[model samples]
Target: MTSAGSTGWNVVQLADIPATPWRNGGGVTRELAMWPDAGDWAWRMSVADVDKSGPFSKFDGIDRWFTVLEGAGVQLDVAGVLHRVTAGDAPLFFDGAADTGCELIDGKTRDFNLMVRRGSQPSKMVRVEGRHSETLNAMKTIAVYAHHSPARVLFDEEVLQLAHATLAWRMVTGSAAVGIAAQGALWMEIPA
Candidate 1:
């Protein structure tokens, strides 16, 4: 966050959010944000701690994206097919309504999750390391989350320093050039 241009931001440290137990009893979750700020949000984001192997809650007509933020990894079962996901891997995208289950690779895992209701909210996310520089436009939100390492962003001549396990997002108003330096971080964009 910075007083730059027409956009404003909210920077959140994940540790500050209260953890809510998952209905499956497999773990807990700390919800980060939801679009519309009201009932029936189009998109949702959160950090989930998977402590054991179990089934995942279903969400019909929703697209799910998952990325490992900490710990070893997990094998996600989607419709009987197994996909191994780790911190170094790209986010896995699958149908939220699919028969999904998780098996831990070793111990518990901390993960980043984004669920977008089909047709209501479209999004794209990428795991970033090193450096990234680009011009972004026509977006409702642009967010960066530093998972296990600190990161930095430069926007509108303003610099935002993101500590470990911090999520910083801005209400994107117009096109702007952004520069980011991070390791094992998640970068996301949601169209306006």
Candidate 2:
């Protein structure tokens, strides 16, 4: 249900954005926050708020994708499914409609969170570590983080340079591209 185009791609550094408090139904807290745009559905980078203890309450009406950014491991209690996630694994997607909470399995954990419209906009948070081609339809926004070498980001026929940390790109509907880099992570946001 989005009509945005592919010309919105722009790169940004993750460290450049200030961390903000994570707000949910009961106003939960997180460590960091970043996104391509502060639109209705916001993609985020969140480190755990270990300082705060939580068997915290859950939330609804949002779609969430969780990807590990650092630390040992993390697990989520969704509805009744206990999903244990580690680094370098595929991201976990669940409905925010469930009564979900998090527990740090070992040490603290850092992760990326994508909150989008339940049905109007469906999205995925992928951890891109090598060369791959992504065919993205609908309105798409990509956030790439360079963990090792500088990242080469391609959008349609254009290319942009990205440094270690985090960067974002906006692509129009029906556009796709391939990315090449030594090491890093890429999260693509799409309509649900």
Candidate 3:
């Protein structure tokens, strides 16, 4: 876990996260963050590499959001309904307990994922390209992920730089305007 300080915000380097093989042996996943750290989590963020077609792990009571970050993409069969998703596309949200399977559309792919326990406040993830900014809406925590391109995040008077494929996160209160400079990035807001 890479970090800038013990403050409310810090950067997480992708290279610092060890990759673990998926339960189904399809590929590996690098967990970025998990709430409560040592016990059952209310939310989690991760990046996964999909190299083969297989069924996704079922989380029973979790809500999942996914976005492709690299390579081509994958076709997801959620409860028998097929959906094709590609890099740079908006995130896809689904029930973690659903019967879901994946098929490689074109070779290997990298994806970003957020999982929130059921009954928790809803969260949002959006793909950002070039220079952009947004106001956090009563979110208790926020994460900004730089995908292929480097990014700079400005919150209040603090400025944080994120190298390619890395991410920065902070526990927030109330609302704030966040300035972002990136060629490509993903912003996620989790409610308190």
Candidate 4:
């Protein structure tokens, strides 16, 4: 991850982030960003490359947003309810405290995840295609991730070119307009 000058912005390239193997030996995760940058972070973002089906780690009192990024997709069982999620499909929001398990549809899959502790702050994540433009909220943190393709972001008089699987996050205070041009991506709004 690299800082974007002194704008309170950080740019994360998935290829540059190292992966950490899972204890279950089913997957490896690359953490994209985390608040506090230390112990007991309030929120964290990551991408997981799953090679097999397995149970997910339970994070009590946390809310989660999940999306399939690549591969054949997955069959997820969340609290006894089965949900089939594929790439380009709508995102799934579930309680992180639930007994959740992921079963790959075919062989391998990559997924994006956002976890935030309960009561810390509310967050919103959504899939973005085509062009998206919105006014920023001064009280909230904002991030735009380019998934599988290159994307462009316009803020003030600046333009940020985001490569595939890249995330551009702004953590500083203040509000400004942001215009994102992405083929397929994720837009996140969280606590600053």
The lDDT per prediction is 0.85, 0.59, 0.87, 0.87
- Judging by TM-score against the true structure, name the best candidate: 3
Point out the higher-scoring one by TM-score: 1 or 2: 1
* TM-score comparison, 2 vs 4, better candidate: 4
Lowest lDDT sum, 10 consecutive residues, model 4, at: 1-10
Model 4 lDDT per residue over 22-70, tens place: 9999999999988877478878899999999999999999889999999
Between 1 and 4, whose TM-score is larger?
Answer: 4
Report the lDDT tens digits of candidate 1 across residue range 1-192.
Answer: 122333366787887888999886889999887777638887788999999999999999988899998889999999999999998899998999999989999999999998888775577788889888779767667888888689998887888888998888887788899888997688887766
Error of 1 at 184 (Å): 2.7
What are the candidates' C-alpha RMSDs? 2.7, 5.1, 1.5, 1.6
lDDT of 3 at 35: 82
Residue 124, candidate 1: C-alpha displacement in angstroms: 1.2
The runs of at least 3 residues in candidate 2 whose Cα sits more than 4 Å from the true structure, single-residue gaps closed, are 1-7, 21-53, 147-149
Candidate rank order under lDDT = 3, 4, 1, 2
TM-score of each: 0.91, 0.74, 0.94, 0.93
Cα distance off (Å), candidate 1, residue 27:
0.5
